[model samples]
Target: IEERAADASTPRAGPIPPSQRSDMVGSAEGVTEMAFDASVLRERDFRDTRRRIQLLARLPDIVAGSVDDEELLVRVSDTLLRATPSASAVAIVRANVPEPMGAGDEKPSNEHPSKMKVLHYDCRENGAQQHSVSSRLVTTALQRRESVLHLWETERNGGIEFTAAENVDWAFCVPLRSEACAGWAIYVAGSRALGSNWKELADDSATLADRLGDDVKFAEVVGSLISGIRQTSHFQQRHLAMRRFFAPVVLDALSGQDPQSWLQPRQCDLSVMFCDLRGFSRTSEMQSDQLLLLLEQVSAALGVMTRHILDTGGVIGDFHGDAAMGFWGWPIELQLSDPHSDLSASAHVVASVLAAARAAAGIRMDYAMGQTEFRCGIGIASGSAVAGRIGTVDQVKVTAFGPVVNLASRLEGLTKHFGVEVLMDHASASALQAWLGQDEFTEEPSPFRLRKLGRVRVAGMKIPVDVYQLVVPSGGTQDLTDSQIDAYEQGWDEFAKGDWDSAYQRLLELPAWDRPKDVLLRLILQHHRIAPSGWEGVLDFPK
Candidate 1:
């Protein structure tokens, strides 16, 4: 055995064997030339690059289903710590989390709430290099608006102790931008094993940074996803909070759209509807001991009105105690028949009429069974009105201006006098008729039945408006028959034509259930069965 080993250990005199030849070359048949991208970055598929890429590719899929903020942070931090060989520990801090809408900006006496901050961390319990993250690194990255690479054992990481390990001991910080947030950033640190040469790695920090570029970009992309999810959640939270103040249509129109362009004061043909609870004063007096219960009932009734208004795509303009005002035709979301036509003008009034009638009928049919009495009087008027925010900077509210708004409120008052739940001005009544005349407008028999109450001048306005009862065929209020409608119209025409005695007699012949005619009967008797000179049948209400 010793003699054979001595012979085998002897050096060869020359490299004459084919297997021992030094010449080595690639075959050109099936190969293509590819150059290194050193000018931009050193292109190499080494361990760290490939591992980070794999982690990045799998990242979005991992965090894609995470909807909650804390849950998302957990998924991202945990995935980075576990998947990336270089990461000793990972920390993602969502800085300056935005306040949810309304964010409890309530009165001082009210109980205010605070929003929770989102912070998540993941660490390997190997008790080695990457146990805790450095705060200096995070601040520096945010200040520079870029990712930063630092050695773990540095004077910059003061007060926090770190033990440099043989495997992975480096820190990375990547700053991120998020919509609707104060600030967002991610901190990933640790080393993957190739060889741990701390001095050489520090000297070649630039190249190391280039190698970590994909990981930096991955952190940013995840940060962006977190930001987007947070923003969407922010919007949803605001949408729900503002539902107390705004209708869904209003919120939908304003969402992702410029509020300055939509809410700026503008002149438009507006159809305004005003609704008020009828027996609120009486009910409040009777239920004063149980005010909370009465308040809940009022809220429920307003909810019905708001639902109807929003269902018709109307803007809920304002709420005055037991009253709510809704309007359309601001040109924001109006779909006009003609491109040059006034936004929603005449046609929109017909829709407003429908919504107002529906709201009144809904109150009587749906709310009458509740313990709280809910009888609403709704008035609809259509004309030019300037619509927009009508308040100071400290306090603002959406409302409309112009004579039409006042007229609608007055018509609402007239519902009590006329024994009707809904009423509309001449403009709205005419538009309803015109819309009903069009074959395409209504496919079913309209629940709305209109009967003229002749011209009447309410307090605070000189011009007498042609009043019409918006009779719902199945409302909680009186449902007039065809004969009753004919009788009312016959007397109204006679009254409009200046035949007071004959008109008064026919109106008296109608049943007392036709309470709308009672006002006419009293007016004729006010003038002693004779038409007063210059009295053109305008029943002026004394204030």
Candidate 2:
């Protein structure tokens, strides 16, 4: 009786084809019910979905921290693959530029290798080929800016008819976009079992992409903030250095030293010089790889020159990229019995830097040869300027803020317009009159070109001030005597004419000990700005 009852209670239909299903026992009863509770199933599904979303959300932050493009792509692909288990592969393709208004845009990475592993295509070697599902998905996402899902029924033979029918059952493509940029495309693919969950996974993946996009935006903001902070800090530091040089007593107090030594500032005689490099931006553009390297070399040479200045009792106020500014006098002014002796020192500094520039240019030739060259124009002005610590304890800055410093900078700028290498104002020329002695100097008429100083007006002062150029002869051993130096200057002229070979040849003739060699090397290396072989001798270029 029990066996008969059991047989009657059991459903008659087993797992069978849909066409063969029995109608008598009712269709619903034919299939076995899932043992799990609906609530538990729902909770598990929600948790899984959240986990997937959370993983995708963190991807952009991770990618942004990557040092280079290759790492960025790899990180993106890995994150997407982990999110969707059915995904056999994932890929991201980026567009070079945004689509124009009312026009169809083409994918920049359409030729990239697919990320799929099942397809026996060597993507790493041959790049993203047609047989790769990952490649197609990346391309599609980049073009559509939307998610595309393809299943086995829709895409067979790895999306190629001639290839063997390899099963890539499902694929999901999602576009990643950042402000003003189309970042990449994320793609995932897997087998039929994975294909069953394709729609749901696609929804989850798209959500993840949105989250990652937000992270990218945040990273950019943070990066910009950091850069701004760095610039501000650098400016403040320069101000502090100037203060320390001019007013030791004030600097001591700011650093928590004795306040008793504070005394009223007095007018002091000083020599101010401004050195500016020409064509720095153009040089940077021409030698993109070696730009940083060149900057470092120039900075190092400047560092050496600065040391020379300090040794000679000169106070360096500020050093900006391709610019060095300093003065003598104030805090403690140089006392010269001859009075004309300061002129020799000023000339020495200019000559030393010129030598350093030549050496730098030579070093660059060893790396990239005659690609680029550098030239610097210097202006010197000697007069009285107030020097003191000009800020509160927390924000104190030592600076020589007066008309003399401004005049020096103006003279430096005027050098280019006048076709002169070194220019000096009337006061500096008079101060160095004894040293000039009709041998190493030339006096040119002041071409009074009026200059606008923003809003302030100087009564009777013209834009271009009276300036004199130094005309040192060739083979002079005092400081500016070297064939290599001449070669450096000639090379710069050739470079300006787009005669790279001639420039390189002239630069190559410069001796190893030449100062301009260093400057020329930096200019040439700017073409292929590779990372320095080691961290030694690196210096920051002025902006």
Candidate 3:
């Protein structure tokens, strides 16, 4: 009989006549007729469609709520298991995934990221991964870049490798990303618990698509989400390390993925800081037998300096044996719309310089080199510099270059000459004073005492620079009190005015142990307590 006889689903304008709707009950003249009903089949299909709709509805929430890849996979795997009651197992696999970024230099594995990394595999009660058959299904799906359906009975593995899991009679696999590495896929397998056929509950009419409704689309959606997450995670990890050097805007540009535009040569105002260990090199030389121990101590000190600079949002640069350098204001300062925007980029520069000085003062490690503490000398200079990838064609680095960089280095060297831990060039000193005049700085007793230490002709430079000392008394170090500082300045004014006798008398009144006083006193004694002819008061540093 045609299904139209059984199907009450024929579209018609009016209800059928009573004779047409009624079943033919008896045989007449060797002719028999029977009317069929399909309400049971329709009801089954309706329930299946509703179940799939419900499962698909829950997936968006699942993807959104998942915090990590593992969590995402585990939750989605649970959903898959619940969706297919006849399924003995479901699995998510990353097939032939390429090695991670920056792994090119390593000796590769035998398969070279081939086959798979099984993300999730769930079977029935007391279940284990059916690797033998599952591997085949994953490979087939990924390699073909499409779905694979296999009947376990027809495709048997007679060799050592088991062709199928126990009681898993049939399986289907769907491809995720075909071009990602090799690819990714998901698979579902039927169990003998439901007998050899799906028809036990399917009324002998169920098809695979009918059995696994919405699964293909669901898996595809999940695959796309995973790909996005993977890409994002890679960038985050890469840039998190880079943040220790690059500015926020530079990092943003990098994340936007066009380095060619912004990373080119940039000339802009920058604050450069140079720090060198005071006694570390001498200690290392003296304790040659314990060189390893000395090296560790020096490294720890550098680490401390590096941490402070990074915390203050500066970029680390050259490593000159016993020293390290870091700077601020790179790749041009885009005005950050932060709450401190009114403070301006100069504020950032000033803050970074102070932090560098504080870092230098705080480093008083005791390596086994005599009884001297491993102190550091820091120099800070603020001016214009070119900030970018600077080097020859083959080798390059993200660094700042210019006279400001040299001045920072020179000031660092002058720290020993001045008998102070930190020194700054004229421009840096002016910036510090400018920032200190602000309301924020006046509220607290400044941690560092800033003083103008007169102009000096630095070696290898024709132009003279006004030197300044930044003093932070720690560890019972002898620092000039306000009274002594006032007294020294009075003497310095006289000395600058060519009244050596007056300067000499005033300087002697201060403590003998006052190193700044001693340095000035020596300068006077060298000039025979008299200003030389045409003396301009700019003491030239002997090379």
Which number leads on TM-score?
Answer: 1
RMSD of 2: 23.5
**Model 2 Cα lDDT, one tens digit per residue, 1-543:** 000110121221122224432211112322111111223223333334566457646754765665644654555455544554544545444433234213443222234333323211112213433334444434444444444443223222224332223334344444444432334444444443343434443323233322223322222223233234434444556447544343343244345322223323456666677766666777677778887787875675455446545545555667788777766654554443355554544443343233333333333332244444555666666667775555565865444667777777776775565444566666655545544343334475221111111111122234434455554332234333335445555665565455555666677775554443454356546744233344222222221
The 10 consecutive residues of candidate 2 with the worst lDDT sum are 1-10
All candidates in order of TM-score, best leading: 1, 3, 2
* Number of residue pairs clashing in candidate 1, backbone atoms closer than 3 angstroms, sequence gap of 3 or more or interchain: 3
Encode model 1's per-residue lDDT on 1-543: one tens digit a residue. Answer: 000110111111111123322211111111111111222222434456667667767876777788677778889888766654466677776443223224353211111112222277677655543344444444445544555555322322331222332234456666665555445677776653333443455433334544565555566667676767677787778678667655566676678875556778888888999999988999999999999998998998888888887777687888899999998876355554555544344657866876887777778876556745978999999888899877887997778999999999999999899888888999999877765655554787765678998788999999888989888867324567778888889998888777988898889878878778998888778887678888676788757
Scored by CA lDDT, what does every candidate get?
0.66, 0.45, 0.64
* Poorly placed runs, candidate 2 (over 4 Å): 1-266, 337-372, 391-394, 435-464, 474-543
Candidate 1 deviation (Cα RMSD):
15.0
- Candidate 3, 238-340: lDDT as tens digits: 6886776764555764567645566677898888889988887678878999878777877888877887877666778778888988888765453433456
Name the candidate that leads on lDDT: 1
Error of 2 at 93 (Å): 58
lDDT of 3: 0.64
